[model samples]
Target chain A: MKKITVGFLALLFLMTLGGCKKKEKVKVIPPAEKQVAKTGEEVKEKPIPKPVVQEESIEDMSLEEINKKGYLQRIHFDFDKYNIREDQKPILIKNAEWLKAHPTVKILIEGHCDERGTEEYNLALGEKRAKAVRDFLISLGISPDRIKIVSYGKSRPLDPRHNEEAWAKNRRAEFVIIAK
Target chain B: MRKILIFMFLSLFSFSQQEITIRIKGGIPAIRIAVPPFIVRATTQQAISAAKEIEEAFRADLAFSRVFDPLSRDLIALVKDRNPEKPDLKAWESVGASVVFIGKVEEKGEYLRFVGKLYDARSKNFILGKSFYGKIKYRRLMAHRMGDELLKYFGQVPIFTTKIAFISDRDGNRELYIMDYDGMNQMRLTYTKGMEMLPAWSHNGEMIAYTSFRKGNPDLYIRHIYQGRDELVARGGSNITPDFSPDDKFLLYSSSLPGNYEIYIYNLRTKQRRRLTFSYGSDLTPKWSPDEEKILFSSDRSGSPQLYIMDSDGKNPRRITFQGSYNASPDWAPDGDRIIYVSRVLGRFNLYMLFLSTSQVIKLTSGMAMNENPCFSPDGRHIVFSSNRSGKYQIYIMDYDGKNLRQLTSKGNNLMPSWQKINYRR
Candidate 1:
């Protein structure tokens, strides 16, 4: 009788553990599926475990420090142009690579413009600039869910001077880490 | 019976003559008038100073109307010693005055009573006489009321009681502020740490809508001026350049959502939004026609910014301006016959008025500074705009033909002036 009871107790414990594991799987699979569906990818790949070195470097650093360290470089555009230039492409590629290595991070892309245009039009133009950068990042295999865009129009200028050089500097797309 | 008939005919003839004189004086050249120093019946220093302030305000209002040529300060000083209640008609006529304004102030307990009279210098008869009562702190308002009465008597629209809403960065941030039409009694409306721009007054003058960055993104907010309450109208994107419809039933604005910027109208009562423009390029700064039949806006669909007009339903979009590569900030005149906009000429922005009936463009400002964001007063007889002529952006008011130019604000960068409608008591 004692032997039968021990066997039944061990079987019940195994079933309970299995039930918990199934629940965990249910919670984790939908996000991966949604991401794959968004990108229209067929491969079922699990999120890579964060690398030791990259994790250590970013684990203690705040968002401000990470941005200050220039892990993500700002991209510039020509006057009234939201298209990515040849020179700006490499910087975007570098930013995408950083984003890919840190799969657990989410970033915000801010679009800004100079004071030459009307405020309302500049706002739309800035959003286009940010969207261009975001699309480029998504094409580089960074999940679209990891990036968000907001435009500052001509309200916040990096350089307050009213000149060509200042305007060129003012019109830019900056990346900020929102969460890691 | 014959004597009675003669008396009736004489009275009718005199009435017709008075009407004819008023019509000719208002429709033709400006009326010449002289303003003498006001008389104070009180003994206190405050009452005396209040009387002088009232006199100054009355003179300024008349001069601003552009329909009355007040006597020069030198001529006014010459008639200073004459009694205001019984002004020396000979002295005023010597200064070429056709009319004169006489005023008296007396203390009445906690209130002050002002009696003002308009006299015809040639006939030596009072054309109009009125009395007003108010607290000493409200002396300017009392004077403004008197000025409006005088304007009505001369067959001109009263502008003294109207207020101008504008954006100023005086408090270390761009915020909404309002002041009297003549630039007195300035008050700040929004105390946000972020930027507020493009203030639009409702037709009833009870509420204001503006774009504020208080929530880290530019959003549209409508504020009840008297209640001090504000509600977010739109969020999550750049929403700006809001204007209340003529009926106050909808708010027309531009929003960047789902794609590029497009004009959208928000129904005030239903709380529903309907997109008005769907162009690939940005369409912004929409102003509803006074009759609510058309919308005037700036669009860059033709590779450069230009003014465009469309029906209120966003159909039959047509281009109205073709002269400049950059024509923007179009505000339709209150009468709906002309449109005012800014154009870049020789790399400098200046205000231009385009008569819609004839397609005639007239440059309203020249060689002052960058003048932009011009709005029409309630009667469409005047325009208020912002200029950087004083080494910084400041609000300015000028007549419809760009005459009577006066500065309204001096501190910080003030821009985007919107004139409120006259609030008449029902």
Candidate 2:
């Protein structure tokens, strides 16, 4: 497993280098004088340095361990509303950034609701909430295929109490790392 | 499906006619009746206990019917006659009971025989007589059958033998369970280890369709309960709130496969599905009209959830509810004139009934507790629903007018009850 990941990272690095080198060669050739300043062999053999991304080594972590890091924060919604609250947008944006960083990670977004709505309608509401969050993440450049959604309806509650504070906490979309 | 629905419609029409006549006759001051202890002719302890259980269960059924006002135990003890035959009619009439039930139980090896006789005390005439024979373990069933017979004799729909399917988390997870209408003989049906909700019973009472997350998604599953078989119906997205068509040939449910919740009908015979609603909002909990021509569902296309009706083939959709901003979980009555639904007002959910002909609404329950998933009994005289008034959700039953509220479950949290009528003839 470790060797496969290492080889995969190497292949990704080589692809990125090839992409950078092609753009430089094209631009230099268009400026005919610059192309002549460099020899044909020099231009062809030039290797572009890869940009470094500061990410902790998570390739060796299990799905459960990676999820325990809590990289993705759960977003909240208003009562009976699936639209992401303005205050919750930042949480989704951060979640999208983390997901973008972990390109190989796949996640499940569980939409939940409070005890205020009926069971069946709350189920649909939960799904709508999850979809709303999933759509926002996709708008932020997260692949839709990497984000799966399920609605727990009002079955799973974060706070078992029956007050406004508890309900506000219950109406949320939780993120779970299913694959890493 | 059309043929089956036509036959059912015919039978239901005749049944409703009987209901109207009986309601008019016995509307004021329900029929006063007497239920004395059964005379047991059994030698073994098992037979005697079985006889006692059957007698108690039968008495409970009659009292729960609300059609019969059972006499007090003191009034029944005034009579000395225990024999079903040759009873003193004068003594029963003197006790102010219009009708009297006399029963006898006999032990026949491993089987038990029950004989019940209903008689009119004023005219001293026999009204109905039934004899049921079954194994000793089916004492409650035998009692229910006798109660049904008495109900049938009174021109009322027989609901004593009907069963209620519900979801319970008593065994550590929400699973499907079923019990008698009187809350006896409770049995667990599913062991999915995942949450199961919204169980809808087929008209035949041999199958139940529900949504389960056993495979990590809310998929529709049909349980052929008697055959010990199961079939996966809908998947690929969150599928929930399954309602069996009146003909039991198709399932009306909602799926988010098209990126939003919409109603769909799945043909059980052909294994095909057809979308019913193309709303940009979520449409869930779709139920069929009694005649199977119209459909009732909840949708948020109007910016908030509300009840809507449309043709079964998904045409000419119209909004039926305009009073509430959030109304959902609508169930049509067997009479095709009344509908029961839950409406959220001020963050509290309550059950309400709508009269389609008059366009009038009546509040069935009032309190701060959440009352939801109200379903009519197959007889259309009573309703079964789940309420959290007791601190945790438990199943409750009440009359159509919302009287005589009784809690049916006490273990854990129970919700989403669907009551179905079983044809004993089958």
How big is the positional error of residue B83 in model 1, measured in Å on the Cα after superposition?
4.3
| Docking level of model 1 | acceptable
Best by lDDT: 2
A70-150: candidate 1 lDDT, tens digit per residue: 789999999879999999999999888888888899998999998766656677788889999999888889999999888
Q: What is the lDDT of residue B165 in candidate 1?
A: 93
- Model 1 segments more than 4 A misplaced: A1-56, B1-29, B77-83, B86-94, B122-125, B367-369, B422-426
Model 2 reaches an interface RMSD of 1.0
> What is candidate 2's CA lDDT for residue B21?
31
TM-score per candidate, in order? 0.81, 0.85
List, for all models, the DockQ compared with the true complex.
0.37, 0.54
iRMSD of all candidate structures: 1.8, 1.0
Residue pairs with backbone overlap in model 2: none
All candidates' chain B TM-scores are: 0.86, 0.91
For each of the candidates, the C-alpha root-mean-square deviation to the true structure, in angstroms, is 14.3, 13.6
